[model samples]
Target: MTATLPFTPPLALASLSGEADADWARAGAEYAGAAFLGGIALDADSRAAARELVDRDRTEFLPDDPLAFIDRELEALAETPIQPAFNVRSATVDPVVDAARVCRDREAYLEINAHCRQDELCAVGCGETLLRDGERLARYVDRAAATGATVGVKVRAEVPGVDLPDLARGLESAGADFVHVDAMDSESVIADVVDATDLFVIANNGVRGGETVREYVDYGADAVSVGRPSDNPVVLERVRDAVARQLGLEASG
Candidate 1:
């Protein structure tokens, strides 16, 4: 059976490196059903990779204590109606499992990082490397799921040798609650992933208005999320309105 996300209207704010935090999520909460906070580095290896990315002028969360940071950030959103979720990157399974326990205790969601393509991250066996290493990624999902937190995987499209539909099936079998697909340039592939698994499908990438929103919904996406523009109220409004119209909810604008 396909698991359903607790939130509704099927719209989310995707994680944006150092920018997606509790404050950022609150800013987009009015327009979203869920908000993914962080691409937080949860282990020593992943933290090293995060530092490398920072050295390259990229943004990352290199918290001194990842679990404490997660708890504080998630706790900040405890009163909000919008669902809170953490998008995390880890080089090993244990940290992800530990992070999931925090999320479960906080009543938030946990999304494994498999969508990042940065060389620093992949070299450390985090991010996009997981996409190519389906078994390892499934292990992360399985271990995280064992903690009883709602879990999912964020994946990107168009990676060579990565069969996303097959990977989606593996994630479902590993007990993922959803699959957040960054349909880079392969929009049609969303349908394939949807058909391949019972996991809730969240389509991402260029989701700004009615056309994009309707396209993903028509392709059988269970939800849609905004990425870089997630903090833009105008874009969020447009997407929110579009989702409402597409989902037959009362129109927002």
Candidate 2:
């Protein structure tokens, strides 16, 4: 059966630090029907200094290789009851390796990072730049699928020359399991892309509450991912109700 879209809060596990233990996962899973693990940032230089900073601030799971760190974290979460999914930051480097690791472990899903707009990341030809190179982006999707993992590519809409509908169709045709659109402050952009693609859609970016999520769902999305919003249970609770109502599921509250 196709996985039902999460109804409760839909735990959007904020990048690694956002979820430190099973309690966080359990809480999110209980409140949100699904959980999304925050992203693992990868740099071309594998900058030790940057990696150190991430380690100091993000999580204790940090490793010399950020990709390896992500692999280890997914392994650790394998025993948990909460369904797990991972997001990669600027997934231009060795995405296949990362997807292979996840596939080896049989994790729930793997998301590509095409939405991050960090200056440092963009400068390195990662993040949204991947979209500019449709050939490479399509190859990445093909590689991810070759790993036998459910692959989804997350992208920011509103980038110059980056047509959301066209990109979504490209990703879908390249074997992506889903096309994650970062709608951030653009409802029209979201609606346009949603209307254009038949692929599973995960709407994110600037989603503040149930009202905002409802708006996106109304536009056409299979599910909406909540990140910063998940930090506040009250807000997540509100979103949960909205998602439930939209999906015709019983509200937990």
Candidate 3:
């Protein structure tokens, strides 16, 4: 039998700069009811640096690996109340090896990123470029799923010549656990496309207020992924409360 999953909101940590005193646990608690951590950017140098950073605390840290570092940090934060989700960089075309390693070690539900529009990332044939080649994307999903990890894919919607429904169906067929649709700042267009997809829909696009989240959820999204807005408090208590209330209402009636 499939394990039951929580209906709490999934908060995404966008582009963290690794400040000296970043309190991830507190950050998680403040935003969503549960914590889904981000900021695991990997390149050859950065990956090595991160591994070394965790190694210093051998007793507290599990090992010099992606999953261990993430797990250790979460544990140290004592934020057991929230579930952990990770956002990592996919620097190569075939991200399966790294993706599987993370899933195995971190024990996380993997999210294959194909939505980042960064120039450097794009030049490397990562992110949204991955979408252009459906077969490769499918392979990555297949690889991640083979590790017994729940796999999700994030992609941009407005790419030229890219058919959203077709891509969604392909990803579904490739065995993705979820399809993260980047709505950017547009909601209506996203809602329309999301309604057409067969996979579990994670609507992400400037989702700030609860009302907008409600519209996405009501429109048939399985869940909503929100980012930290510059002006809003780090812990978006209002949004969290609103999501919880809406979920509760839905469950009851």
Candidate 4:
């Protein structure tokens, strides 16, 4: 069954690191709803592994202490007045625990990134690597939730041989507040995830405009995220307005 947030704004920002500036102020101001910024690495190991790879459509800079780096990034946008959520990851659970501890009182979510497919990240048992280890991922989510900060798990929908429904159910059982799925081209995966878990489902991948936003919401996703279109200010605004119109919600700056 589908769930609803406390409030649903017309627009929601999908996590975007490459297009956003040092401070995500502009992205925050882009819409008054959710802003999922940064797929930050949470420890030295993951950072080093990620840094070893060439930059793709992602940010290549890796900080020695990734948690501290993300801390500053969040601090930059802390006062943005939107629903702020940061996507982060490591091979193990400690860094996620540490991040949740620090961001506990900030009301921001710490999202576990099981959505990245980078070769280097996968080599370190981070990113979509976790997708191959459902048991470990469950424990990881359990530890993150133990920190008392809101926990969300971002996942890739098209991983071969992976049972997406079972994984979503496991995450929900493990106490994830949100299960974010990059549905790729399969919107049916969104529906399956919704059936498998009661946690809020966030549908991503090729979400271009308000129509696509409504399409996912109609498919039982609690929310939807966009990538490339979010970089275009005018297009973003149009999409946001369209979301507002479709959802019968008011549009905001």
Off by over 4 Å in 3: 1-6, 9-22, 30-36, 39-79, 93-95, 230-235, 249-253
* RMSD in angstroms between candidate 3 and the native structure over all alpha carbons: 6.2
lDDT tens digits, residues 54-141, model 4? 3444565466666676677667766666666677778878888888765565667777888888788898998888888999999988
Report lDDT (Cα) of residue 5, candidate 1.
82
The candidate scoring highest on lDDT is: 1
lDDT of 3 by residue, 1-253 (tens): 1212343554443323242112654544555433344445455543443445456541111134655555555445443444444455555434445655555554555667677665545655566777777888888788777767667777777788777778877888877767777776555656666666667677777667678778777766666666545225633555555556665532110
Mark the regions of model 4 whose C-alpha exceeds 4 Å error after superposition.
1-7, 17-22, 54-58
Question: Model 3 misses residue 182 by how many Å?
Answer: 1.6
lDDT of model number 1: 0.90
- Order the numbered candidates by TM-score, best leading: 1, 4, 2, 3
* TM accuracy, model 1: 0.97
Q: What local lDDT score does residue 235 receive in model 3, on the 0 to 100 scale?
A: 34
**TM-score of every model versus the real structure:** 0.97, 0.81, 0.73, 0.89
lDDT of 1 at 57: 94
Taken over the whole model, the C-alpha lDDT of each candidate is 0.90, 0.64, 0.57, 0.73
Better of 1 and 3 by lDDT: 1
